[model samples]
Target: MDQFTLNLLVVGATFALYFGIAIWARAGTTSEFYTAGGGVHPVLNGMATGADWMSAASFISMAGIIAAGGYDTSAYLMGWTGGYVLLAMLLAPYLRKFGKFTVPEFIGDRFYSQSARLVAVICLIVASVTYVIGQMTGVGVAFSRFLEVKASTGLYIGAAVVFFYAVLGGMKGITYTQVAQYVVLIFAYTIPAVFISLQLTGNALPPLGLFSTHIESGMPLLAKLDQVVQELGFAKYTGHSDTTLNMFLFTMSLMIGTAGLPHVIVRFFTVPKVADARASAGWALVFIALLYTVAPAVGAMARLNLISNIYPNGTQSDPIAYEARPDWMRNWETTGLLKFEDKNGDGLIEFYNDKSKNEDFNAAAAAKGWAGNELTVNNDIMVLANPEIARLPGWVVALVAAGGLAAALSTAAGLLLAISSAISHDLIKGSLNPNISEKGELMAARVSMGVAIAVATYLGLNPPGFAAQTVALAFGLAAASIFPALMMGIFSKRINNVGAVAGMLSGLLVTVVYIFLHKGWFFIPDTNSYTDAAPLLLSIKSTSFGAVGALVNFAVAFAVSRATAAPPQAIQDLVEGIRIPRGAGKAQSH
Candidate 1:
């Protein structure tokens, strides 16, 4: 069968399965919609959480970022993995025991203020909407290439698919659908890695293959990769280029951000008991480790494969003529993601770092009469195009297409659910209309989700950065605003309503303003005063500012709380009750 037909068949089958699950597990009440009826098995919930957690950024864009940035980009892998651990241990079980329907709900009740809940709803929407934009971007990239549609058109179609299942089944459908998505995505991710690993290093397991010798070069795989990239003016594959401070803050942001994300935290609420929540988190870590470990191998192998294809001999030799470029290049070029322009008007395509500081490489390029880098490859395309770049089988490529879609759609559903629940549950029922009927609230949830999907699709067309970078910004916002509030609510009895509100607003405002100054106001193109290359702060990019925002939140909360009256005695007792290990299991029963 042709590649397009194979892609359609595989991707269509997965969509069909998602719809089937949605219908079979359709939610009937607010409880089912919000928390999947609170009866999902721990292992099953963990698998579903794995799918929910690994969005388009993780599946489609992370490896691409790693491939281009090398060691500096490992922060994405480290931060996300560590953040999941932090979320699972520091927050998940406690939140689940509290038995709130949403993050804002927990915050509102814990702080004993309706104003706190409303502020949390705002924070949840801001972070989740930003996150959905990244997922939609991935959907566009995957669809534009495989489905042979314009990126905007792909986003519209993806929105339609998400609307059907997400609006119909709510969390109940999303949870089960995500479990199936996990299976498809993991198989799709690991199979390509296995094939490429064997092809490059004669090792079947990708993690081991990463450290194994390159079959043809007889050198350690990373050592060979570093030599090749450095020869072409790129940084060493294992060398750090970003500052230690920025890396440290970036990692911390992602870690705490994971804990704060309403979509991820809500997953814990789907389990039957507090212990089940903990068990599910452990299982999720194991499942997440599967893809996270293979990602580095895939990135390294694909980078090598890509450069090897372009420089058939070596970087010093003449590159392949533009007309002689491989089929993969032609296919990706159609999507406008991989492009070649002959700046020197030479027939050959030169793919190298144009801004390299290497004098010897510059002199060599000057002697060769090279003008500048001619090939522009988008980082988001690296993983999606990896199987094709490596000349893998058509089926493997098709599987990847399905896997990428599954990853994007699964996370989009989760984020939209968080957004919708925040609106309908926290804002409408909890605040605006406390007497709202269950049926009315359910309709509001669906409508809110539909609106969120429309907004997400619109923003996806004009994303501020690549998928992973956009997602990182979302993480930063969550870390700054929501995480500090949740932590203080659960751990500290002195954090009154005024303090919680002050901290969330202060953290969110600072981070948003910092990002806008560098990334443009609301991410509009060419409207920014500064760029990440020369950030307003000292070596602190907007993406790294979340950790700083989080610190500001904690400081402000403490200062404000100490200057004001203490939390009510009942509130203090409530906080104490949630923290006590012995009574934690009984609280779930209450």
Candidate 2:
């Protein structure tokens, strides 16, 4: 079968499987609607959380960023995974013990203020909505590249599939579907990586292969990659070039953001007990680490593979013939992720950093009779193209396509669930209409889910920013606003309702304005006047500014809380109860 047909068959079948599961496991009660009935095994919850957390960023774009940016991009790996440790030690168990339907619900009841809950709801919706746009975009990109459809068409189809399962299954359906997604995504991700590792280094384990000697060059793989990329005027593969302070802050932002993300936090609520919540986090990290450890290896090896394909012999030798280039190159070229031009009237492709204004690199390229580097490749294409580059079987390639869809769709469903619950349980049920019936609230959740999907689809159709960049905003908002409020609610009895609300508003406004100034309003173009170089304040890039915003939140909250009366004794008791694991049970509608 043609690649497109095969991809369609594989991806279509996987969607069918998820839809079937959703139909079979449709939620019936409020408990099922919110926490999947709290019957989920720890391991299964761990796997589901892994699938939920990975999203399009982990599955589709992370390796590509690592491949292009080299060691400087290690912030993504460290930040995203390190956040789980924060979640486990500081947040998960307590939240589970509190046993809430939504993060905003916890904030509202804990703070004893309707406005505080409303603010939390707004933040939750904004973060989840922004995050889901990236996922829908990822699904579009994968489908367009593999299934031979326009990105818009792919997005529509993807949204339809997710809506089918998410609206039908609620948390119950999503949890089981995510377990299946984890299986598909991990298998698809690892198989091609293993093949490529063995092909380049004769090492079966990709992570070890990254540091081991390359079979072709008899040098350490990373060392060889460094040499080749440097010769092409790019930074060394394993050396840092960005400012250390910025990297540190960026990593910190991602870590805090990860812990604060509502969709991820809600997963802990589904586990049967507070102890299981902690254990589930450990298991989730184990599952996440499986992909995390292999990612750098994939990034390094894929970069090397790309360079080898372009140079054929070595950077010192003549470029590869255009006609003899692999099918993967021609295929990706069609997607505009990879491009080549026959500069200097040569029939060969020269792939290098043509924009290097450095004198030494320019002199070298000039002496080599090269006009300029003529290939432009998007970093997001690296992981998706890995299987094809390694000449893996058609089935493996199809499976990878399905896996990418699974990763994107699973995360989208999770985010939608969070968004829906925040609207229904926290906003409508808590304040807007306390008399809403269980069936009425369920209908409201479904309506919100459908609307959330529509908004995400529209944003995906006209992406305001890159996948990772947009996702970073979601993290920044979460880190600056919701995380501090929740943490202080548990850790400090002095933090009053007014204090929490003020702090969150300040943090949210600062972070949002900073991101908007750099990324533009709603990520639309012609909106940003300053780049990261001329940022709003210090040497901070918007991506790293979340930490600063978070600090501002803490300071404001502390100042305001000190000026106000302490919370009621009952509220204090609730905080203390949340800290301990005893008597934790299925969270109910308040």
Candidate 3:
């Protein structure tokens, strides 16, 4: 069968399975819609959480980031993984013990103020919306290539699919559907890595293969990658070229952001008890590690494969003629993500880092009649294109297509659910209409999700950055606005409602403004007053500004709390109660 037909068959089969699961597990009440009726097993919740956590950013863009940026992008892996640890240790159990339906609800009650909930809702919507833009971008990229459609059309299709499953099933349906998604995505991700690893290193395990010798080069795989990339004017594969402060801050942002994310936080609520929440977190970490450990291998191998393809005779020799390039390049070119221009009219594509600091390489390229770099490959395409680039079977490619969709759609559902819940459950029912019936609230939740999806789809078209970069920005925002609030609310009895509201607003505003100054107001192109290359702050990129914002939040909250009255005695008692084991129902502050 043709490639398109194979993709359609595999992708369509996955979609059918997802729809079937959603239908079977469709939620029937507010409880089911909100928290899967609180009955999901720990292992199952962990699996679903894995799928929810590994969005298109993790599945599609993370390896690409690693492949292209090499060691500089390790922050993403470290940050996201560490962020989950933070969530599990510092936040998950306490929040689960609180027995709230959403993060905003928890904040509202804990702070003993409706305004705190409203602030959290705003923070949740902003962060969740930004995060969904990344998922939508991943969806568009995957569908655009595999389904043979325009990126916008692919986005609409993705949004529609999410609408069906997420709106119909709610958390109950989404939970089970995400479990199935986890299976598909992990297999899809690791299978190709295993194939590529075996092809390159003669090792079955991708992680071990990364440290193994390259079959063709007789050098360690990473050493071979470093040699090839540096020879072609790229940085060493294992080099740490980024600023230490930026990497530290970026990782911190992602870590705190992961802890603060409402969608991820809500996963714990789906379990029956606080202990289940902790167990679920452990299982999620295990599942997450399976993919995380394999990623560096996949990235290094794919980078080597790409370089080898371009310089079949080695970097010192002439590159392959444009017309002689591999079929993988041709396939990706159709999506406009991989482009080759015959610079200098040589009919040969020279793919190298033109801005490399190597003077000898620059002189050689100039002597050899090379102009600027002739090939442009989007970093987001690397993982999805890895199988084809390594000449894996067509079935593997099709499986990858399904896996990418599953990653993007699964996370999209979770994010939209968070947004919808914040709106319908926190904003509407809690604040606007306390008398809203369960049915009405559920309907509001569905409608809110539909609107969130539409908004996300629109923003996806004009995303501020690539999938992973956009996600990092969302993490920064979340880290700045939400993490401090949750921590303060749980750990500090003195942090009153005024303090929480002030801290969240100040943190969110500062971070958003910093991002807007660099990334454009609301991410409109060319409207930014500054760029990440020359940041307004001292070497702090907007993506890494979350840590700074978070500090600001903490400082502001503490100052405000001390300047004002302490929390009510009952509130202090409630905070004390939450720290103890089995004090959930017994605490009666609010």
Candidate 4:
């Protein structure tokens, strides 16, 4: 069957399964909607948390970025994975012991200030909403390809499927849905890696395959990739050309950001006990490692495969003629992901890093009758195109399409849940209506879900490239604002409402402003006063500014606390209570 038909069947089947599960697990109470009634198994919650954590950024974007970025890209893997360790150790169990339905609730009560809760709600919304934009775009992009619909139309379809499960089930719905999604996404991700690894390196294990000799070249796979890419004027596949300082800061920001994100931290609240929260985190890491460790292999192998196809006789030989490129390239060309221009008019495509120009490179291009680079390949295409690039069957390609959708939709659901809970549970019920009925609160949650979806759809219509960057930015924002406040609330007895509020706002404002100055004012696409290329502060890129923001937050909060009255005795007692696992309650605290 044709690829499109196969994609439809595969994607459609997964959607049906998700809808079935959502219907079976429809939430019945506010508690169910909020924290799956706090009764999930550690292993089950671990799987669900894995799905919630690995969004479009992890599944679709990470490996592709790594493929293009090579060694410097390790920041994403190291930072993101390491953040969970911090979350599990420093935050998860304490928050679970606090017995709160939402992160803002913990902040509000521990600080003994409604205003502090409001600030947390704002922080959560900013981070979660921004994060959803990318997942929405991922959904739209995946649908546009598999369904052959306009990007916006495909987005609506995917959003509708997510709404069916997420709105109806809340935490209960999402918990089970994410478990199924984790299975689908991991299966889809690993199957192709296995096939490609065996095909390219004659090794069944992808991680081992990365170091194994290439089937065609006697050299190790990474060495072969380095040689071929450098021959084409690209950096070596395993070279660390980026400044070590920037890499360290970026990784640090990501790690801090991961531990601070509300959506991810909220998953720990679903388990029955503080101990379960800790165990679940360990399992989540194991599940995450399954894909994380395989990604470099996929990246290295896919890069090698593409170059080998374009230069069948080797980089020293004539390049592939444009008219004679493979059908997969032709297919991707229609999506604007693969572009070509006959710059040299030899009907051949030459792709290399123009930025890596040198005397030898110029001389080689002249001798080879090559003009400037004639191909522009988007990095995000590497993973999506891996199956086709390796000549895998149509079924595998369709499964990948499904997997990408699952990744995007699952994370989008988790983020939206965080956004809605902040609005309804924290903003409306906590502050606006102390006496609001449970049904009224649930309705508010659903309405908030609708609003978040609308905003995400609008952004996804022409999603910025940075939409793919929300994962890191969200983590940074969380690290800078939420994580510090929460940590101090549990670990320190003197941090009062004033200190907490000041710290959160200080961190949030600095991080957001730094991002805006470089990324453009509000990411409006062209209104920025500065750029990450030449940052205003310490030559640090805006993306890595989160760690700085976090440091500032800690300093400001301590200074403010020293100047202000200590937290009320009631609040101090509450913090002390949360630090230990005893006296934990069954029902969530308002």
Clashes within 3 Å, all models in order: 1, 0, 0, 1
Clash-forming residue pairs, model 2: none
lDDT per prediction?
Answer: 0.91, 0.86, 0.90, 0.85
lDDT score of residue 335 within candidate 4: 64
lDDT of 3 by residue, 1-590 (tens): 99999999999999999999999999999889988988899999999999999999999999998999899999999999999999999999998888888999889989999999999999999999999999999999899889777777888889899999999999999999999999999999999999998998899999999999999879898888888888889989899988998889999999999999999999998988888889999999999998999998888888988988988887545688898999888888877778888878988888888898999999988888889899989888999999999999999999999999999999999999999999998989988999999889999999999999999999898777779999999999999999999999899999999889999999999999998776656556552122354677877889999999999999999999899999899999988877764534311211
Residue 232 error, candidate 1, Å:
1.3
Q: How much does candidate 3 score in TM-score?
A: 0.97
Candidate 4's TM-score reads: 0.96
Instruction: Give RMSD (Å) of candidate 4 vs. truth.
Output: 2.0
Let me know the TM-score candidate 1 reaches against the reference structure: 0.97
**Can you give the TM-score per candidate against the true fold?**
0.97, 0.95, 0.97, 0.96
Q: Which stretches of model 1 miss by more than 4 angstroms?
A: 520-533, 581-590
With candidate 1 superimposed using the best TM-score fit, by how many Å does residue 18's alpha carbon deviate from the native?
Answer: 0.6
Q: Give Cα distance to truth, residue 542, candidate 1, Å.
A: 0.8
The residue pairs that clash in candidate 4, if any, are 257-475
* Model 3: colliding residue pairs: none
Query: So what's the TM-score on candidate 2?
Result: 0.95
| Worst lDDT 10-window in candidate 3 | 581-590
Give the range where candidate 4 is weakest over 10 consecutive residues by summed lDDT: 524-533
Model 3 ranges with Cα > 4 A deviation: 520-524, 527-531, 583-590
lDDT of 4 at 274: 85
